[model samples]
Target: MKAYIAIKYHINLENKELIEEISNALEVNKIKSCCIIRDKEEWGRKTFSVEELMSISFKEIEISDFIVVDLSEKGVGLGIEAGYAYAKGIPIITIAKEGKDISNTLKGISKKIYTYEESSDLVNYFKRLKETSIIHNSI
Candidate 1:
C-alpha cells in the first residue's frame, strides 16, 4: 500500500540525518511516500496561514492510503497530521523517541506506534512491519 510520511519538516533536516534514514526506509519498502515539505522552497517560510495549512494537509492525507509518521520531535503540525490520518480512517505507523509524552490528541486514536532508539532500529522497524503485514494478509 502507498504510505505518506508525515514528519516535522519546517526545520532544516540536512543535519539531522534521520529524515534521510526514513526516506531510505520508505523507498526500500517500495512504498510511495511524500515528505511534509513536498512543495516548500528552501530558505524561507511558505507564507501559509493555519487554516490553509490544515486544509492542504487534510487533503493530502485523504489521498494517501496510510500514514507513516515520525514524531521524534514534537510539533503542532505533526500532531495535526496524526490526528488527520486517524480521523480519516487511515492506518498509522508512528515513530517517536522513548519516554516522550504523546500528546493527548494523538493518544485518543489507537495507532500501532513504535519507538526507535537508533537509526538502524528505525530501518528494522520498517522491514518488520512490512513483513508482518504480508504475513497477516496471507492468513
Candidate 2:
C-alpha cells in the first residue's frame, strides 16, 4: 500500500536515527511511503506560498491509502495533513512519545493511536500492521 508519514519535519532532521528506524521498518514490510519528513528540498527552510504547500499536500493525500502521523512534537503542518486525511476517510495511525501530550482532540479522529518509548516500538507497530494486513493493496 502507498502510505504517507506525517511527522515533525524539523525534529526528524535533528534526529536522523528516528527517520532511519521508521524508514527501515517500512522498507522491511515493502510499504511505499511519501514521507514529507525527508523531502528537504521541497519543504526545507525555503518558504513557499500557502497555495504551493497545499497543492503538494493534496497530491500526497490523493496517492496515499494511510497516514502515520507522529505527534512526538505538535507540528501544525503535520496536524493539518492529518486532518485532511481524516476528512478524506483515510486510515490514520497517530503516534507520539510515551507521556507526550498529544492532544486528544486530534487522537479522537484517528483510526489508531500509539505511543512509543523507543524507535523499536515504531518498528514493532509496523510489523503488527503488516501482519494484520491492514495496509490496503495499492490501486
Candidate 3:
C-alpha cells in the first residue's frame, strides 16, 4: 500500500526526526510514502508556483491508497490535502502530539486519529495495526 504524507511544509524541515520516524514506521509495514518536501529532487530544484504544487499534490493523492496527516501544527495546506483526499474517497489517518487540539472537521473525515507523546508511540501504533491487519483492512 502507498500513503500520501500530509504535513506543514515548514514543520517537515524543522521536525525531520519526527517525519523520519513516521516514514520508517510506514516502511516497516511495507507502505510507501510520498511527501513533497522529501521528494522535491524528483521534481527538480526549481521553485514551483502554488498552483503547480497543488496540482502535483493532487496527482500524488490520486495515486495514493490513503493519507496520513500530522496535525501537530495547523496549516491550510494540510486541510486542503485532507479535504482533497476525502473527496477522492481516499482514507485519511490523522496524528498529533498528545495535547494538541485537532479540528473537528479533520476528525470527522479521518478514518483514525492517533495522539502520541513521542514518535515511537506512532511507530508502535502502526506496528500494532499491522499485526492486527487493521491497516490492511481499513485502507
Per-residue lDDT of model 2, residues 75-135, tens digit only: 7887788889888888887888899887877878777788899868777788887777665
lDDT string, candidate 3, 59-119, tens digits? 9999998899999989999999999999998989999999999999999999889999988
Q: How does candidate 1 fare on TM-score? A: 0.76
What's the best-to-worst order under TM-score?
3, 2, 1
TM-score of each: 0.76, 0.83, 0.89
Q: Candidate 2: misplaced stretches above 4 Å?
A: 40-47, 137-139
Error of 1 at 76 (Å): 1.3
From the highest lDDT down, the ranking of the candidates is 3, 2, 1
Off by over 4 Å in 3: 41-46
Residues 1-139 of candidate 1 have per-residue lDDT tens digits of 5667777765455423676677677778676666556543222346466677677778778877778777777777777788778877787777777776666656566356777777667667777877878313422
lDDT comparison, 1 vs 3, better candidate: 3
